[model samples]
Target: MFESPNELNIARKEHKHLSFSAGIYYCLGGQAAKLEIEVAFNCLCDKFKQPRLQEEPVWRKNSNMHGMEMLMIAI
Candidate 1:
């Protein structure tokens, strides 16, 4: 048997909620706003069946908006 010269991390993980900075970050209507957005996304997903990406998304290549840049989808 031989050893491999590569990397394998089994602990590190990432997601949308993990993007925010630490501490009690708050806003006047932040909770409401997030609920609204999540509801909207859920509604869209319910309406669209198997909505898939047409191509590789161009997300935050170089822009102020860290959100989705170009999400080419086909319902």
Candidate 2:
């Protein structure tokens, strides 16, 4: 569904699918999760002067989910 997976656009609104699924399969905790992530990321950015990846990230093994299991970052 994503034409350019490498691109990052936090303000984009033309998504075909929600991160937490859609309709009857939608997650109730999606909003809370998103808020938590935003807070955490903001905290990290504020605290770290120069944050960077220390090593290659380890991807999760789920076919339906795309995420990292292990990501080592240096600040």
Which candidate wins on TM-score?
2
- TM-score for all models, in order of appearance: 0.51, 0.71
Give the per-residue lDDT digits (tens) of candidate 2, residues 3-49.
Answer: 65534445567667667999998999988998998998788889999
Q: Which lDDT value does model 1 have at 71?
A: 66
* lDDT (Cα, tens digit) per residue for candidate 1, span 1-75: 213212122133432342343457635566687689779868878999876667766656554435556768688
TM-score of 1: 0.51
Candidate 1 has an lDDT of 0.55
Clashes of each: 0, 0
Clashing pairs in 1: none
- After superposing candidate 2 on the true structure, give the runs of residues whose Cα lies further than 4 Å from its correct spot: 4-14
Off by over 4 Å in 1: 1-18, 26-30, 63-65
